[model samples]
Target: MYFERAHISDGELLAFYKALLYPRLVEEKMLLLLRQGKVSKWFSGIGQEAIAVGATLALDNDEWILPLHRNLGVFTARQMPLQQLFHQWQGSPLGFSKGRERSFHFGSRQHHICGMISHLGPQLSIADGISLAHKLKKEDKVSLAFTGEGGTSEGEFHEALNVAAVWDLPVIFLIENNGYGLSTPVEEQYRCEQLVQRAAGYGMRGMRINGNNLLEVYHAIKEAKRHALHEQQPVLIEAMTFRMRGHEEASGTKYVPPALLEEWARQDPIQHFEGFLQFLQLINEEGIHDIREALKHEIDREINTALAEVSPPVSEADELKDIYAPAPSPIPPVAGAATHDKRFIDAISEGLDQAMVQYPNLILMGQDIAEYGGAFKITDGFVARYGKERVRNTPLCESAIVGAGLGLSLMGYKSMVEMQFADFVTCGFNQIVNNLAKIHYRWGQTADVVVRLPAGAGVGAGPFHSQSNEAWFTHVPGLKIVYPATPADAKGLLLAAFADPNPVLYFEHKALYRSISGPVPEAPYTIEIGKANLIQTGDDISIITYGAGVHWALEYSKQHPQLSIHILDLRTLLPLDYEAIREAVTATGKVLILHEDTLTGGLGGEISAWIAEHCFALLDAPVMRCAGLDTPVPFAASLEKNFLAKTRMHQYIEQLANY
Candidate 1:
């Protein structure tokens, strides 16, 4: 039937109607499941389905969609099987997450969909990276990112939009303004009248549309896609809509006024669109009823089948698998150890150069890394050697940089992100702790990104620049933490981090960057991530340490040559080599755990506790711990020396030796 009243073709209109009906039907079934205590929770995009469906339909099938938790319509448009969707909600083995993640926290690379994180805004920056990959590959594709009006309030939202604008990336930032951010009204969320208005500040074109109107959303997104693909520009589209239901099934809309709810019910997107279809002679009342009944029946059959399937068994061993990407095959160590000395910084730069040469997909990104060679000249001449595309100089946006690296990793590129200083990693902690660390465990995803942290407290860079924050990441599971003390270890561990199939936080000591020099193999070598280096073997006491503490221990042992102290340099903190630690303790019968981070919650406590529990009999005295004072690193050299336990190590070593 040709509908003269509707601008869209009959086929297009029908597809749009079915897309809308599918999610609505599934949402109704989900609610029924919730009532029957079959499903845990659900975030419904009831009135906002048009925005999800229309915006997704506007994109080409080859383009990527970074969906939000409520974007069920996007999954439907992407041809996600109804059975899989039901299985996911039912926590069955057939789901994408294998019952590991809840709700829409799963995504399929095969489907070109980046899964949603609980922290919704970080995906925007990741989408920017995906768009960047598309641009680099010279592919005529755009990445569509979906988020709610509430997500715009997050700093990541601004960071992502700014990066996208600055780079002219092909990304469409679609915002579903559902009037409330989990019961908090739009009036309280932001001062701007329209959410799209904020895009102008980021140098992007912005538009506002009626999200409930399918045609308006579809056309707006089509224009946005055109701008992104052709002009390499990002566009922000704010779809003004309402949350017809509560935030989730459990969170009822008691906060919503009855009058407002009643008003929205009258302007329901489905009913309004159905009326338009009727007016266009495309569908009558009987046909609409039949379509609804068919959709309901299909949804019921899928849900029943999903419920009947057996869920995957969860075991401790299964949980432990894939925590770290399988380690790459070991490269045979070069014959003979006598080699020319290379500075720590030189070793690191060489390692990066070698890794990039080995893997064409390896990309380096950070502030001032390209022309300026980074803050410490670690990446000096990298851009000139590798070109600007592979060695990117990004703005001073830590979270976005990390998130972009995550996106690049998802796109089959191994990215190394340089945090100008370790302390500044706090800015990107959300991406590190939540997204990068949890993605693998949640959905068996791999984020092969290495975050280079120039950490420690010796150069008198003060509190902001000098920090040994390895403990922070060591506490997080699914992350490989490596702190290399010497130039050789630095090069080897960095290469290993790039080679590993997991997210790695490589802590490079800032003070030792130039001061430390040692014979590093010119050939590329990888020091296993979980292994420790026995710097010196003695019989009196064992000093268990890492990073700059190795230097301190060496100096202390040199000063007190009478004390037979064995020093074990723990190169990898997370997957600690407890065997080496036990060997040292058994050989010496005394233990001293040391680190540069603060004493209270430093890695020393964990090591000490482990030794106390397992190797308590081997210890002659208490497992002594000497770490930095529990205070911010001071500025003055004298005070900084006192803040760190460097000066006190010798005193403790003497006391332990005498005892």
Candidate 2:
């Protein structure tokens, strides 16, 4: 009944009408720019303005919004400047993404908005994490995440909803059911009668409404927000509408039937809302004409101003900026016999414990990490010390864990995520690569998150459990990869990673968890990420390696002291210490690069190539590499021994020494 009348105040009704008009005017201008070859692309929300405007207006100012490409009205409702949007479309530096991204792929930290990636549903899990942060901070604010009907089919959607429901986080999942995903109709996408029905499986309330009715969308979202904030629960609202325009400006609607298009056009939300405003006498025809003309003039002026502005300069220095946060001030090393000789696992646990105590904003999330102390007992006694609130044991969903960590990091929290096994990281590869690795470069935002990967093979864990996957992440920019070979380095690097303002991937060799023990500092200490440690010095040859390869090199050196070999442990894989590498290569005049990862396409290849290109004159012989065979790790111990680099390092060193 309330939907049949003017439920809001006269002032608010007029404001909503203005919000509806703002996007239509701007989008029409964008279409013109596309036609004139000024803008690259435009994803119009012409028919579904009500859903974006109503849902966004229902939120508090402190609340956050994770918008999709089609939700331009959300930005309009937030009062984002028209010039900024036009500059973004024009690829100018004044844009939110600093000209790094194009249309609809930008966000504002000031406005508490997140940019969208082409990957559709990952933002949902990220919103779940932000909502968790709000709940933990005891704030009443809720986060609203926008996605299309097609996104509901992604596994991340189910994982996000389940996590939010389990934790009772204050998050609102708004699904804009616009009848098609690009071109495929909803009937072919899912067999369910309604997509909102899936919410029952996640133990959340679900609501479906006529998305074209602006008043119904507004009221439904207001109620959903109330439930999320007051009850500390998530709610899913499906606003049924249709995409009147093509997916983008260049995409024609040839796939959509003419009769269906006519039916949706007849129910346009802007026209319907204008009729309602006139019926309530809130505005007259003259007033409507004034509003439309004023918006058009304002948009035209902004577009012209943006076009007149100079574009951002392209430079070689700009290519290197924001790849990593500035290195923290050096901490004085504590001199001692060692506070305690601890195993690798104990050192890592102690490091995490000390970091949690040092920074209240630091939180830990992983499977069986809280009460169970993790599968490897690395986090033993953590929950008892830090409580279940900070030390959270998440579901067996890697993508959700990583996505939520990214969300928490965005909200000024340092999150440490643990994968049950390093091999399981493949499940979250999309988030790690697309979102975590690109957030800073794409939008000038920090993702202060650390992912702990238990890696290596030696305990007969087989292929699934044993993997040295650091090489997979080294190829990705904006990511710092650390491989610690000792208890002390493990403790130091973990602390450093927590303090860093960028995303870090820490690989802890599973074999060294207990087998390796050394004296560690009693207090927190940080080892610079890009610096490598010179394990031993000699003149015959330089053995370059990291992780388990460090141990193999040490054993080979000790067994063949007559060879006088030098070993350089590369702790950080991405920001490698080229100076240290050059020193090693120059000193020995012969080099051998070794790693535990597979031979072809391994990190050793990069190091070897660099040595060949930069240190060619310093080399006495061609650089050689000893690494794992190009095959999956066999389950048998006998077969595994032959598959590793340890078997061939000694032989390769002898041949290089003879040369």
Candidate 3:
């Protein structure tokens, strides 16, 4: 089948060559900077420059692009300054002196190049959702997401492709088959001979092209973009290219077979494309030499100019610059008294009902948030109460569900994404981490989104449904992690998160949904997102914990009369309550940190580090940490108990008393 190409006029062809030449020169300059220890690390798309240049030339400058780590070529084609790009690689605070962010997480709203993600495959889903948004908004823009062959292994790739195809979204999935995924070759990564065939499974058109051939790459991308913009159908283009450099500066080609490397080098995209230009008489040898020398001098001058620019002193006070959009006239907790009291499930239902009444743009989406009112029935009667538009059900794809929420949130919608079970959150981790958690930090605080995960291990849910994985998110900056233990706190935190300027991961302990009931106000309310709640006060010891552990610590305190256990219920885990913890630990002279996550890298370790550094002298004993065993939550009920740390409160108290 013949596919037509658009936007490859002589002017565009020249532009593609110019873009490739410019970026290659800068890449070489940056490589020298790395070797000289001026830059930290880099992943260069040295040999595959044509694919990036051609794809960008075919793409609309106003449209969105989500590139993977080895996409400096695409970024340069989009006119990202080589100097700023170099400043980023050099580990200079001036790289992001505008805010606190990493080098690779760069995206200019003005340029419409949605930031790049270091992780693999997840960007595909994000690109799909953003394209869906453009369609919904009736815009002509299309989205292009690029990844390696190895990224196809990720379930997110399948989820995003399925959604894009099913909805006929305007998105192009660019699979740059550069022979290998790091050290593993494409053949080893998938049994299929051609990566484009994978698109057929998603009901999308798939095509293969010679990525090393500049003309072929340009024509293929143009065809893909034409189909995307006009038909509004997703297409997958598998460009057979070669990786000429190591995965990163730290990685070496020592593991690669010498013969294989030699053969691939013969088909290097730059050399192949340059030869093709000569064959077509598009440019002579003198033109090629002039372009190369001009690009090198321009890049060299840019590097010197950027380096000469003063590095703004990084101030500690500036740490809060883009943490979250400043709350517009603080959303004070509702002043009215509680008319009715209920469990966590009822509180969430009531909060959603209230939000629908208040904000017309608010949306509730999850596996069963609409008809089922959520798997745990938290949104029970929501569909009937607010209609399907406000309360929506989604396909089983968690990544797409969350990515869609992010898209809606970007369009000024108050979107809440629900994960039926916290343990299953790994399915959407890429969406949460790569897109939602870091969006505001990357975009300079323009994103406001909320994701709710029903977490904690209980009720014999087994490994797939029961887990307390809050620690994984707490470790990430620019994401607010909240865990509410009671019905009142749950409702308050949910409202606060909606009002919050940044993305929030609201972790609702599944066991506490209906297990614990409390008085909840009907009006709008907000409990501070980062502050800890002192549930009880005592002298001898302080039990610092959050979520289900707070209730467990209280129970232990009741069981033991000798130990006066002060319990601090940390509602928000990310922006930890260091001051409150210090005061409590200093007053009590001892500390015991507890959580439900696995012991290693758990919240307890972070809390222990804080107490050790801040309250060392007041310690009666070394801080004690009690967490789940470092193993998967088991399927068997008895084995699950063994894996969990329930009934350890009494044992922990006894140990603390002895210490």
Candidate 4:
């Protein structure tokens, strides 16, 4: 027999009490383990357990949640196995990260939680993507993400909130105002009096609530979800809570005033919630005591079992294992298929058109990509055909847009992000390199995203507008890089990029977009990602190149016909077509690695080193490199011509042939 509580049943209140109690017991035990040297570090959410517990319980089980480092209650409240959580903390083999990561630094797809990286605010945009997927699929699901008062200072914080509001995505951005960000005081973090005010500025409803009050947090989130799902709006919530301990155990709390610590200590959330329940008759004093003891005992047993279990096995094979998930096999191109001449840009556009008809789950996101049809007009009129939901026009928020694309892929949808110019990708570099690239290796989650990089120089667009940045992404693991050199390959490679389950950075040369025309397949097809296309063959010297340099190889061959060059177009930069490279090197002992990027630290350097190690004895000459000069792209055509690898660099070819 039980009475009603504030807008919740007595049973619900009892549920809240148990939910809040477990995380508290676990945090206290973690702190003990930290001192005892059983655990290396701990992020204690001791005083603010209610925020994580209450918010998680408020959401539907199927809805996604991205929790921060300090929010362990989200995991416990979801009923994630206690042993698995302990394993994650202790770096046991049974951990979410298979013991590669020690804290709540990784996420569980089964638990429907996306975990945050050290770059705190990036997860906000990732949450935007998960919600975007739900909205696109017409699923009645709202996504919630956590951030700290200090994390609000990040650029991603603004971008995520702005995009979510602009798109009217079903997202709940909860800001845990713990009053400090790694010892930086709240006063220093912002000029405004409250974080919620910024939400209004973004044209979204803003709410500020007492985070320590479990019922208030639960009700607020419950209502926020309702508003988001029913009305298709995003809400920003500022949960007023306190960080009861150091940012980590290493960063001591000596900066805080003694009186403030005492005040917050007296207002401990677990104690407050216990007292409130006692007053409501949801639980008597004995019930509260029994709950804490039982939870503590449960944690104690789980920790003991986890402690005895072995750590994850470490091996070089394990280190190199599963960086990229098994890519989808490419749909082979038709044999002797009917073809018509088309521009490089049109071929790309056609590929996207066919991919859309195929994937249905494919989403296009970038600045001005919908109605305006993208900067280069590659997606021109796409919004009319596919509609705005699928052909999304993102704001100038590159970071959030890219993060949202990652979220879309996490939920079994394929997404393409057009970085207006490849040079502009720096804005979203962290999301690409750290989040998208590392996600598969870090947590066994494949990021099925295709980032369309409109790259290359010689377009007179200058440094900001023109850059061959394929080398940057190629350096990172867990990403596929494709650089198509012809209209046919452009269409075929794009289809391939979209088909691949792993993340792909497809580089399309700006200079070749409309300037070049060739036969392209009328229907959808895919060229395998790692394979190279042999444009022409010769025995004297092999010129290995891709993208704009492929044209360079063809031009050099026409200019110096007597030399006889084997021109190879490496459509894929990463996975490097080493087999073709080896064959080229073996056939003609003289090889020249030509590229459009800078001479130093270009992909050529890595290719040269690789060839030297494997195919050195076969070489008749030093692997010559003719590349763009190491300087910012000059606007002056005269200056840029000197910077690029042109036919005039015939000396290198002659020298290689003679040697």
For 1-659, candidate 2 gives per-residue lDDT tens digits of 12544468889888889988899889998998899999888888989998988888888766889999888888989999999888888777788877789888877888889988898899999998899899889988889899899998899998899999998998999999998899888998899999899889988889998888888888888899888888889999999999988888678789999999999998999888888888888888999999999999999998888888887688668767866667686464577635789999899999998999989999899999988999998888988888898999998889988999988987899899999999999999999998999988888888899999999888898999988888999899999999999998999999999888889999999999989999888899999998999999999999999998899998888887788888999999988999999999998999999999999989999999999999999999999999998988888999889989999887898899899
Question: In order, how many clashes per candidate?
Answer: 0, 0, 0, 1
Q: Which stretches of candidate 2 lie over 4 Å from their true place?
A: 1-7, 336-338
Candidate 1 structure, TM-score to reference = 0.97
Output the TM-score of candidate 3. Answer: 0.83
Q: Top model by TM-score, which number?
A: 2
Q: All predictions: root-mean-square deviation over Cα?
A: 2.0, 1.3, 4.4, 2.1
Q: What is the TM-score ranking, best to worst? A: 2, 4, 1, 3
- Lowest lDDT 10-mer window, candidate 4? 1-10
Q: Give the best candidate by lDDT.
A: 2
Pairs of residues at least 3 apart in sequence or in different chains that clash in candidate 3: none
* Each prediction's TM-score versus the true structure: 0.97, 0.98, 0.83, 0.97
Model 3: per-residue Cα lDDT over 1-659, one tens digit each:
12122445666556667876777777788889888887777887887887888788777788777777777777887887777777777766666325344556677766666666666766777686677667756888888888788898877778888878876888998988887778887767999878898887887889999877766777777778888888889999998877778887688777778897798778776666666567767888999999888888888898999879888787767666655566544365556665577888788767767777777777777787877777877788887777876676777898877877766655556778788888777888777877777776565635566888888787788888888889889877778899998888888888888887678899988888788888887777778888889998998889888888888888877877777878899999988888889888976887888888889989899889988887899899989888899988887888877777664656776777888
State residue 647's C-alpha deviation in candidate 4, in Å: 5.4
Candidate 2 global CA lDDT score: 0.89
Candidate 4: stretches off by over 4 Å:
1-4
Q: lDDT tens string, model 4, 1-659?
A: 12224567778778888898888888888888889988788888888998999999999888899999888899998899888888888776688887777698899888899877899999999888898888877899999999999889999999999899988999999999998898999999999988899987988888999888887888899889999888899999999988878999899799988888888888777788777777777788887788888888888898888878777567777767778788778787788888999999999999999999999999999988988889999889888898988999888978898899989988899999999999999999999998998887778888889999898888798999888888888889888899999999999999998888889999999999989999987979999999998888898999899998888888878977787788888899877889999988987888998999988889989999999999999899999899888898888988888888873468788777777
lDDT of each: 0.87, 0.89, 0.78, 0.88
Pairs of colliding residues, candidate 2: none
